[model samples]
Target: MKIRRWQFAAIILTIIWLFVRGVPLDPQVIFGELLLGFILAIFVTWGFRRMYEGQTNLSHGARVLPYALVYVGTFLRELIVGNVDVAYRVLWPSMPIEPVTVYMPLRVERPTAITTIANSISLTPGTLSMDYDDEANALYVHTINGRDPASIVAPIRRWEDLAIVIFGEEADPSDPAPDIQIGGDIDGE
Candidate 1:
């Protein structure tokens, strides 16, 4: 509900509107579009103002950009690596794959951070975030290979390290990650 929060949302929406509309040829038209886009964006942001209310640290906000950039880089790297691994398995029928569910307990308990982590896991290849245990604050992740749990977990933990700072989460990266429980039907049953 804060003006500052609404302002940021409106500014981002205006940028998106511009991208979707594309730049006009004439100078006057370009200026007109920008002005209209911003006006509409402001109104739209105001309409959804309630959704912006959540735990936010203005101090952490300033530091978040750098960490966010790093997290994106890590995510992309993992995405590419996952794609290659899945592709390899697809090409080679003889490749051994042990499918299992991993219980990944998160250090960050905030809703936004938890959702981000869950979506990121689901987005990556060969891994899916199946369910969330609210009481344990843990996620059940299904991966193509569980024989080397470290390989599957390493990237996720790296993401968490950056996410902690990016989302202004209270969890510390130095805190030990809980031992992940791995078990599932080994066969494709």
Candidate 2:
């Protein structure tokens, strides 16, 4: 296995921490600690890239940094707005909720990009990413007031495209769908 720089650092740090803790350095303990440190280093590496499916060796320079910043900014804004909206709806019972499920087709091909879109939708108010059918490559999202699933697709695809810019690689968004439906209503819910 090719050891990443960070993984090596993690292993060293773990060993140092264990040594500083004054644990008795028996042969068994030393072997166990080495094994534990190795495992922890691997775990850290995996966790850092949990979103990605395959090995990601992209240069983290101008190409990815700006888009990542944008993604964070947009996500924070949406999260705050969604929190306020959900709170307001909870406080004011007059808010109308048209519960509906939309079969939202995604253009992002990379697993990480797709996951980010799904997570962002679920995080925002009034929407939940119910499931992703890998067989059909589509998402089932439930929304509080969904009037047009097609319209929502545009915004979601936009977000995914930006995510691709940050994470690298995505399917083209120009592909067309027959129709987007919500709650078995052609008009949407």
Candidate 3:
């Protein structure tokens, strides 16, 4: 596997850190770790972007920092709130469970961004992305308690706007449409 510069640099820096910390490092083990790290990095990059041709730009990489911070902030807050919400539902005799599946229409065009949003929603508590229908241009997500399908789209779309800024900019939401089709299922699985 071809080694990217950052992957090599990360390996080198990690080795140096271990040395500075007085951790024993065998030559064979270090070589193996370097190879493994490089391979994993390549795979991760490919999964993130099918069109990414390994053009490593340090500047572009830095853009992820702000996006990551925002995502983490939102994730943590939602996680805590979700936990409490679940706890309340469990403890209450009412057992407030809507268990609804929403078919959300997507406005984003990039597959990577759309997938990111889908994955994020799935990862968050109380919701799961079931499927996608490219022909219908929509996403089917199962939510623990939702009043309507639009509820899923609103929050995800907001985060998607932030994600667009984090990863790459696209056409305005108000721009004329090309009738891209999509649809999906909401089984929370």
Runs in model 2 deviating more than 4 A are: 1-55, 58-62, 148-154, 170-179, 185-189
Residues 81-157 of candidate 1 have per-residue lDDT tens digits of: 88999999999979999898988888888888888888889999999999989998898899998789888889889
Give the C-alpha miss distance for residue 143 in model 1, angstroms.
0.6
Q: Is candidate 2 or candidate 3 better by TM-score?
A: 2
- Predicted model with the maximum lDDT: 1
| lDDT of each residue in 9-59, candidate 3, tens digit only | 554455554555453468776666656655665565446554444545557
In candidate 2, where is summed lDDT lowest over 10 consecutive residues?
A: 49-58
lDDT of 2 by residue, 134-165 (tens): 97668888887666555456556667767756
Candidate 1 lowest-lDDT run of ten: 180-189
Highest TM-score: give the candidate number: 1
Candidate 3 minimal-lDDT segment of 10 residues: 178-187
Q: What is the lDDT of residue 103 in candidate 2?
A: 80
- The regions of model 1 sitting more than 4 angstroms off are 1-3, 18-37, 54-59, 184-189
Ranking by lDDT: 1, 2, 3
Q: RMSD (Cα, Å) of candidate 2?
A: 8.5
Per-residue error for 104 in candidate 1, Å, reads 0.8
TM-score for each candidate, following the candidate numbering: 0.82, 0.64, 0.61
